[model samples]
Target chain A: MESFFTDSPLDHETLRRSVEDDAAGAVLVFDGTVRNHSEGHTGIVALEYEVKLPMADKLVARILEEVRTEIPVLKIAVGHRMGRVSLREPTVIIAVSAAHRDEAYRASRKIIDRIKHEAPIWKREIFADGTSEWSLGCTACK
Target chain B: MPKLVRVEIRYYAQLREDLRLSNEEIELELPATEEDILNRLAQLHPKQAALFLASRAAVEDEYLPRGTVVQDLRAVDVIPPVSGG
Candidate 1:
């Protein structure tokens, strides 16, 4: 298992390789990238990700452990990017390996979903208009 | 004399933007609670009061109950709703 929060751009290939195993027949990967539009806003410039580093690191580890226990996966690796991510740039990646395709796919799905909702990372959308807004991930803040 | 305690407050996302502050240090009355600290922050930044009231507080990396005494708090992170993918 591996988890990281870095200001550097994410490398999906590196994450996939980290979870590669000889016994595993399937290696599934999920990449969350910055898109060009959100809601009704178009011509998006980039996404800014800010995190409470210590809490985020701890939560990512917890999520990885929980997912591993629930799924019979051989290996798992997850990485999230901090700082600014331009359009089409990846913000997060989750890779998992298992003896079969089903386990790998399911584990990868669960990891990403949990990380999005449970982690203390936040994202802001920067539009081409030079305006930005925080994405609503938690109800209390909205 | 009543002692004063120092608490560090860290902001994130929209709260940070609204207050134009990433963090701040405040001296509070001794034996203050998390709510007291938040209320104090709201007073200092009235424009962000609603956000403060809606946010959650974590002290020393642990989620703090509203009524928990904060005399020993070294820092508090005010977390807005998280939106990550």
Candidate 2:
């Protein structure tokens, strides 16, 4: 899929191959993982993501379309895991392919940034201390 | 009972936690706008007025302008500042 939100673990091979083509010379993938720490929260256990489907799904598609038009990338695919995502596991993955490394790299970065800023998805960090807090909220979308 | 329009309100993130509610259905006077719905919610939840007032309302697929009329709307999402990557 070009963009989506899934409750299950993301499939990497399929995401990569979704943009695989002979016309492309470079394909870059970005895997955003749930880490052990976030700012003041340490020993994080997992990250819980909440998204309103159909709306979120639609917004993601709009983002991809906007990115595609702005960048020279030939193809783009994005996947984000919803609900509880354990540490070290990929929470989001973005793959972009272009005729050159520069375009691919630029598109990959731009897409993720906009997704983070625009998509109506929420993340709460679960700490080892038995407390959780939503990260500094998205100012742009709010 | 007075004329009314019921709008389902779905809360998210900080606002949901603060309100201790996932969603609720609210009844407003017949001529209600997205802005009026929010004001009523804030009045009903004075303690969390800031969050309620600051929330953005979305109907079926898109976020509605605060001043847009809400009579034809069936559901509205009260979105707080998001934290997604």
Q: Which candidate is the best by TM-score?
A: 2
Q: Tens-digit lDDT track for model 1 on A12-128?
A: 889999999999999988898989877656788899998887898988898889988898999988889898999999998988999999999898888877777667788888988
Instruction: Tell me each candidate's i-RMS in Å.
Output: 1.8, 1.6
Query: For model 2, how big is the CA root-mean-square deviation?
Result: 3.1
Clashes of each: 0, 0
What DockQ results do all the predictions give, each relative to the true complex?
0.63, 0.62
* Candidate 1: residue A85 lDDT (0-100): 96
Clashing pairs in 2: none
TM-score of 1: 0.81
Q: Distance from true position, residue A38, model 1, in Å?
A: 1.8
True contacts kept of 1: 0.91
